[model samples]
Target: MTLPEAPRGRPRDTRAHQAILTATAELVAEAGYAATSIGAVAARAGTGKDTIYRRWSGKAELVYEAVFTETESGPVPDTGSLTGDLTALVEALVQEFSAPAAAAALPGLLADFAANPGLRSRIRGHFLAPARTRLAEVFERAVRRGEADSAVPVDLVLDTLAGAVFFHVGLVGEPAGPRLAGQLAGLVGRGIEAR
Candidate 1:
């Protein structure tokens, strides 16, 4: 007798997904991506290596998902004013980069992406574009409110603001406190100002 096909697209167990992501993040933080093997992750996650392989083809995909998952939520702070909103956004971005877990994983992830152009493309498509789109929405709102110029290039503006925050967190290695937030806000505000 022919057996009926198993149910397609079975709902994933949220707990398992979270456990894998947690295990992957901790491994990357402790050993860096290059050193984190699927076996190690499986052991840490209390699952079989086959389970991880079933979910992801390999380690890079798993690590990519782990790092990007941490920042899956869009960054859009509504502080009622453009300055307040931008300041909060930058501060949050800095916090993400500065977080020990993120800081440890991101550098390795970026290096891997550099080695593999395809992975870089995946990161841009999955992570960077969504972030840029969200920032563009904020810029659009500011333009509509007459707080920013409609003619400004949204990508350039976003890159400048985000780059400044990344520079501080990635390079300076210092806490991005209120003072840095205010400076970034001032720079972005000036760029947004109507000519």
Candidate 2:
């Protein structure tokens, strides 16, 4: 069933949106990205190809939304300490990346990110930018609390989290857990603490 046209964007059909997203994630995870095409996604979602195209510009856009927006969890955490916040954030990321579909989709997607600057930019804009901003805020609070040095670069925090998550889930194929996440958080905290 086609949704009645909306003025600015696709029809406000949440079910269709979610279905399309889930289908996209599943397809990419099941087949490589090269095999996950718009027509396939449309058929899998039981929606018209037009519906998928109406919402996203192309394959990268569709997959970016499916992987980032539809799956992101644990919104900006406020755990009082930088270590606590980082641990929570890292744990959430582990959960997100290690999910069945994401677990399957990520290895291929991560490879794509290395090769496609445009894909990286779109995903950074859609998801990572906000996450980085929240992390910056958490770092700021830590500095105020004397947990981190005032001079520590926020980039270090960002990179540390990224590295830890990727190293465990992407390279080693280990599920992310509180212990590992906590260790990473503690490492970031001590490494950047004011001398």
Candidate 3:
């Protein structure tokens, strides 16, 4: 479904935008996503619902941006080798998913994804696409260097790395650290390596 973009007009106020995102994160953390509402977010942000609606389509988009967008901060690392690259990528995923906002918001965001097909696509566009694009470069390098199969399924590799961390941190509530990241990278790296 095509969601409406914010009307083209005066640029949004940076302070107000940050306030809305911060308020959304705080409310989702304090009350859980199921209980947080657009009204509550507006109240906490000290802005009206119209201000938020002008920027985002609904709570799902707002919450996803507030909680998930920050995780895409830096570029994915390239360490000259598949295992090394995977380790860096996996470590970042572990850290991001384990953060307080992500830890709290993921479950609810995932629920929203299940119920809203449009949201699922939007999230993939906003959140997953960038990461996947960068990761595709990594995979290409590995293949060129003969470290991985030319026909390796990049999506499965991504799913394995991301899904494992999501289950460990988001669902099991376990703390994943660099060690786990290294181990996961090694395991997946070997699996995808020229075999």
Candidate 4:
């Protein structure tokens, strides 16, 4: 499927949409996720609470989209080899998860997810599904090229990479740098490479 078209001409509605997302992200960054609210986001965005409400059902949905939408929208990498593709994808993930806003927002978001199964399911459907679908395409290409085993588990690979980043950054309190991406790709590549 084609990627969604970019907004044209800086329309007012589009501007407001972007503003709300930006405001939500900034608030979550400045104050913890629990502290951010739709009212505050609306105020920061120079809009009204009704405007935010019209776009999102609640804080969790808004914050999830604010923090994650960009991460899921990029072009899928096809760098010829499995290692190269893995490196590119990992680098993007590292860059995304390592961002100050995302790092600050995710813990709170996950906490909300634990409390709300519907929200979690919706989040998975919207953001995670697209990313996984793209990753599956990458893996399918790798398998076709004999660079990866067909038996390689996609979800496990995703969990490992995402888990490592969260653990390394959130628990260890160390920055996950670009170097980590290449190293991670190398290790994951070893496991999936065809015999």
Candidate 5:
């Protein structure tokens, strides 16, 4: 027997979208990647499996959007000086890496990255590329202002700063806050600034 189709004229439920994403991130954080499932997301979100499937094809698409939605990079503001720009950049770093989605999903995502080249590629393209482009803009501006040496390796500096925070978060379990931020800014800034 054929099931009756519902009427087509209807608005998309943005609340359901948000609920699904929130539930996905929380689950990733709580259960790790291997354990987070589409069925679980649907249940936790208080929505039907059909609703989730209608929007997202499966787990990867849903989880990726959940982690990347709030973290996409935009222009980092010119804080007037290189140090200020650097500080702002690091603050953005803290915000991105410390976000609930990233925090919960990273452990599993990194593992997946090692084994799944396609997943790694998607992450690099969608998330890392945008953030790197913005950081490069900040450093390029600093160079134009003559605040830092044009010869300064922006990639290394950025990697160092961001990697340090990642290490502290993943290994030491230290909080990424203003104090740690200032210290990082000072260390990297002192090294990068023209002396």
Candidate 6:
């Protein structure tokens, strides 16, 4: 039997989407989200405001998409061992926190979240939830493999790991590097390892 041909249409330009996101990140870093207008993003991106509005409804939606567009999803390494996986996971998290654009944008994001509960929820759903889901899968796999406590809540584990990294970066103003990752992995590994 012959397979059906694929549908024909103009493919979306991910490059343009990335340019807009990059512009948004830069603008938000220079000016807080409250001040970073869609017009500015359009200007920086070399795209029309209409194009941005076509993709997103308004400033909040655009900001949310821009922040989340920077994040990548699963395919989190298994590495055939819980310790290795956990270590890699921590390293990835630290790397993300240490990125210049991400680092610069975080303070403004926190401020925006504080000002608007509804916007905060939108961000949590779009950005935080996906990352948390990937991390939770790692924890769940460890639990199934008898490497971690089944009783421990996945949300708690995710919060602990992320909270530790963010605290170090945001509070101490230190680069969340391998050292921080190692420290976090050590603490989390001990908690998860079967006793």
Number of the top TM-score candidate: 4
Error of 1 at 100 (Å): 1.2
Q: Candidate 2: which stretches are off by over 4 Å?
A: 1-13, 68-74, 121-127
lDDT of each candidate versus the true structure: 0.74, 0.76, 0.83, 0.82, 0.75, 0.72
Stretches of candidate 3 exceeding 4 Å from the true structure: 1-16, 46-48, 121-127
User: For model 5, how does the per-residue alpha-carbon lDDT over 78-98 read when each residue is reduced to its tens digit?
Assistant: 878777777777776677667
- As a TM-score, model 4 comes out at 0.84
Candidate 1 structure quality by residue, lDDT tens digits, 125-179: 6656766776777777888888889888877876787678778787667777768
Q: Pick the candidate with the highest lDDT.
A: 3
Candidate 6 lDDT over residue span 1-195, tens digit each: 223453332233455677888898778767766678988998999888998988886776677556643545548768767777778877876766766655666766677668887776675466567777777777778888888888777777778887887788755678665477777787888887776
Candidate 4's clash total is 0
For lDDT, candidate 2 versus 4, the one ahead is 4
What stretches of model 5 exceed 4 Å from their correct place? 1-20, 42-65, 68-75, 99-101, 121-123
Better of 1 and 3 by TM-score: 3
TM-score of each: 0.78, 0.77, 0.80, 0.84, 0.71, 0.80
4 versus 6: better lDDT goes to: 4
Model 4: ten consecutive residues of lowest lDDT: 1-10
**lDDT-superior candidate, 1 or 3:** 3
- With a 3 Å backbone cut-off (N, CA, C), the pairs that clash in candidate 1 are none
Task: Please provide, for model 3 over 1-195, each residue's C-alpha lDDT reduced to its tens digit, 9 standing for 90 to 100.
Answer: 222574543245666898999999898888888888999999988989999999998988898778866656677678999999998888778877777878778777888889988877775566577677777889999999999987887878878998998899878999885589999999999999887
Candidate 2 lDDT, tens digit per residue, 1-195? Answer: 555565544554677888999899889878867788899999999999998888887777777668755424446778887778887877776766676666666666677777888777775456477677878888888888887888877766777788778778877888665588788878877788877
**Model 3 lDDT vs. the true structure?**
0.83
Instruction: Indicate the residue-level lDDT of 180 in model 3.
Output: 96
lDDT agreement of model 2 with the native? 0.76
